[model samples]
Target: MRGSLTTCVLFCLLSLGLSYPMMKGKPNDTSSKPFPLEDPTHNLTALADRCTDEGFDAMTLDDQGLIHLFRDGYSWSGFRGAAQFINETWNLTVSVDAAFRNHNKNQPQTHQRMYLLQGSDVWGFYEGHLLAGYPRPISQEFPGVPDNVDAAVECHAGECQTDSVIFFKGDTVYIYSPMDVPVVKQRHWAALGPCTAAFRWLERYYCFKGINFTRFDPVSGEVLSTRPLDTRDYFVSCPGRGHGHVARQNATLMSIKNRCSGRPFKAFSSDELGRTYVFRGGWYFRADSSKDGWHAWPLSHSWRNLQGEVDAAFSWENKMYFIQDSQVTIYRSNPAYTPVQGYPKPLQEELGVTEVDAAFICQSSDVLHIIKGNKLRSVDLKQSPRLPGQERPIAHTQVDSAMCNANGIYLFHGPSFYLYKDVEEMVTAAEPPEPGNIAATFLQCTE
Candidate 1:
């Protein structure tokens, strides 16, 4: 029987005009194995010749909400923060039940558990292990649903108000809820066919078919702009593999105007994330001298939704606050830097200041020092009525930007930075340290 199956598979491959490179073995040997899964970390080779060469068998979010893509005997994990897959792969061991043909979607059951359908049985996968008392009959769990499910996703919050699981099979969809009978309806979307896998990410619905995916409105099924994006480019973080790399390369090709000779418009270091960002105009440098002293890429390229230049910025409580003309945008301090909802609020309404030359909060402190020209104003953010504290004149006549760390506060003016060993000296000192060229001090640029 095994020999017959091998011959059948080889014939099918030949009929499709494809190669089947199985391990060498005797004609009747059952020990013949398929090609070994590539070690993505050590191989340093592209997983596929092209990003769209192979489609993921199953797509799902893991316990930490990171995306997990499963394909032939292998899996890839990545974050939704960016449109690129991380260059890493792992061997796949979990087996899906054969009961439901073409079932390719996985959904989270809770923070610690996920629902995986194998064959005709449903299992609760938790923390890389299957939970006990599972392998339940699919018919029992999803009563009237037929075999051959295309995909499934648990819609929550913005996608759907109630706890709902949507199962797709060809032109039919089953909206199932634990508290009610399954709601059946014919596929309403016209642009997309039956997706092999589907999942909700970043408050959007993504339906995957082969290696391409379509983002559509979950309610109306209206195909969103930029449909059929390569999953590898958008979902996987493959190194030097996506449009993001091309954008950076293009930016590098263009004259990335070096601003080391001038005052930075804004500068801040996130101790929580261990990153320092220096900005001027639309370009910003991430203070990595080894890579290059000054590589100014557009701010919008890294910070999605934020445009042009920022007046002032600071990191506080694991969130980054960017102050523009009269508005402020807050973002969770992560690789994605996802913007907090109800943001870009009136700056005056949130911080009681319409404009700022520079702003920074010291490490482990709630007092936000706002700089305007030479004047300084401190606001106690922890207080409910965040009224601006008493204003005072600073040593500098006018400063460009400011940042604070454990060592002290550094104020930028023109092309130099003046350091005050600490905040107390910043407020009470008669004279600050002799200013040093920003290029030499921070960027390690000579002359």
Candidate 2:
């Protein structure tokens, strides 16, 4: 089956490390040889690509190939905070701050500050005083000011901006500036909070804080949904109280539940089994227990210890694959009840799978892409059993991250990661859209 260009690029780079030329003139096709499973220390070409020096606090792949990276930058109040979309080729970035200063002498400074950026334009929102104790919305939209407005204010012999309190509510952004003239009007807008974890499914934006989940429309800034649960509950009790995982199978707004206690759901793989299994905080769990909800059959008499924390897990062809401590571990049958002999050994030792802190696994056509630690690698399961000992480095980069959709794999590098159409088809072929009455368009929150 054909693979992604990014995958091909990675394979070529790996081939180069093995002294194999991937270009047209190469004599031997050593690329098919299995990677060396014994070598521990391997040489990787220093990443030639220049990445952002400021580093990224968070990164995600957009529908387009562009990478959306949130970076923390310096601010006026000696308080440093994140600036969104600092760099983007496909994804948009916005900045959040609680310390923006307004310089108007007549205005009393408030404490709210937020900045929204789309493409090259920016909208600075502040809630504080503007002139002589009279409260006003301090903004740069006033005429005669430079389109790219950067202002500094002075207060109490110290130079600073006055307006600092500002918050964003979808498209209807709000600013609160305190002034001498107190207007006794209740602001219906919720207080601006910290922007931490974020995820995008269709038009809805998902933000999380531990177990508390909130959904908003990126365009309209309207609050859509909020669930107070960690990653497990976020997927399980998604739609509402009564909604279960069965109804979520083929629906656009589907929900999966943790009907069984102790066992939590892991990554979902679109494969032949159509069986969804849960990992009980470890690599072991009851096998094929889709009916019992728990302890249907112990795959192994003793749980197989991976020797490290599990970072990623998926199943294909009735086999379970997991990444732990940068090493790939595959089990022939579910770990709960399978015999020791049923577990497969590590696929390759030279994949340089270390530093694999996190992962998002998806497929392109028949090729499986493992995205972790800012790099993407393609693994062919069809060929996995054939060369039980061969190993190869798929791809490596310091500038990109990957996400999967039905159409293809989204690669986010530097400012932008574009979508490769073919890769998306394989990943979404068997998977169904998340179930719910997801609004076709997210309405901007004006209230």
Candidate 3:
């Protein structure tokens, strides 16, 4: 068996700390050791050679030492890898299962991609350039879907032109539109083998099990046909996957212990242009999805004066902010997306802000809002020295974090949501009284 969806799903539940108990099967007397693998396109070295960009759109080497490139469009294998080949003169579209998403984001134009879980941290193409991204917790982002679930995502299925992605958990199936979007739109339970791979051909979806395959009705979620998967047909649909995990008669699946290893970074964030910058220790590396392989770059030198690992960072108005300790350094993005000249401004001296744990910008105004605890403050670019009216308190228990979209402020306390409008009020209103201050309003609102 190349992959055991059974094992993959088990890994997901465990990673989430789920309480599901696993049923054990008696060990089969027939067992085999791991088989040898070949690098036909030298994808391993090719990945390293590409450096700066670690994007493997599509290519694979089979047991025969035969090299394969992106012939169709995107190719993916669950928990293993995935790739997309766009920018062909024809401007073609194809479906592939890109299951490993540590981080996911959509740009202004809806150019989206998901980062993989292993070997290559990020995998996907951006603007005809394959760009790699940072690992994100997919289980948390998509709600019902797990990070390890194998997906069969297509841009057009039946009458829908937007991308649609399918997910499987145990015997259940999930369907989603705008394939790259992080939300789950639909789900269903099916009577079939744990799905290892799924593909679309001749207007129908064929989901493959270990030895059997089921053809599904694209629109109704009906299992149209269940039959054995012939080697030739299986090889045709998933060459990239086939090359990585060879089909063997008695190969046991890799254990869950193996999945949680070799992380490139501890935290990640993306910018307006859909570029994800990763940080680990004191070093920073841009996971350029438009390119391939990982040749990491040291970070201490880029942002002069500011050293030590970054506590947290975000993007506002196309400029990148790097925060370390109580200080914050600003960097301008260049053509290469690396930090350019003029930086290392003190968070307190430069913006009249200090002890900043989180940050964002109001789309409606030119101010950059900085937050620490339940307090809220804004730095108006037009206004030089920060004034009293620019700072106010958000009446919350403890402000864990905050964010801004076209809508006003969103304050998060634990798992609860509280929205506050009028940036002026949030920054200018007198601190709402605390303890015995407004028992009537507090008790009534709580009730």
- Candidate with the greatest lDDT versus the true structure: 1
What's the residue-level lDDT of 297 in candidate 2? 14
Order of all candidates by TM-score, from best down to worst?
Answer: 1, 3, 2
Q: Which candidate is the best by TM-score?
A: 1
List TM-scores for all candidates, in order: 0.48, 0.25, 0.35
Candidate 2 CA-lDDT value: 0.29
| CA error at residue 230 for candidate 1, angstroms | 2.8
lDDT string for model 2 (1-447, tens) is: 000000000011111121111110011111211122222222223221112222222222221212223333211110011122232311223432111222333543322222333222433443311223221232322212122211111121111123222233222233233444321111232422333334332112344333344544433335654323332222211122211234235332111111222122333233233333333233232222211111211112222444333545555555556655545666655312232354434534523344443234443234556555433456555663432222323233332334344544444333233444544442334432232210111101111
Over 249-309, each residue of candidate 3 has an lDDT whose tens digit, in order, gives 3222221111111222333445565555555555444433211211122353344444566
Stretches of candidate 2 off by over 4 Å are: 1-271, 278-280, 283-308, 334-352, 355-366, 382-447
lDDT of 1 by residue, 1-447 (tens): 000001000100212222111111221222111211221432234442223445655656545333454444444443212112322222114532111111222233443356656456676665556566776777887776555576777665335534566776664566655444545444545566576777654344667677666665665667764535555444443444333233324533233334444445565554455567777765565653221112344555445667767778899988988887889988887534778999889988899888889998888899999999878999999987778887888888888889887668889877788988776788787776788888676655554
In model 3, the runs with Cα more than 4 Å from the true position are: 1-76, 79-271, 274-314, 340-342, 386-390, 413-417, 421-447
lDDT of every predicted structure (CA atoms): 0.56, 0.29, 0.40
List the candidate numbers ranked by lDDT, top first. 1, 3, 2
Poorest 10 consecutive residues of model 1 by lDDT?
1-10
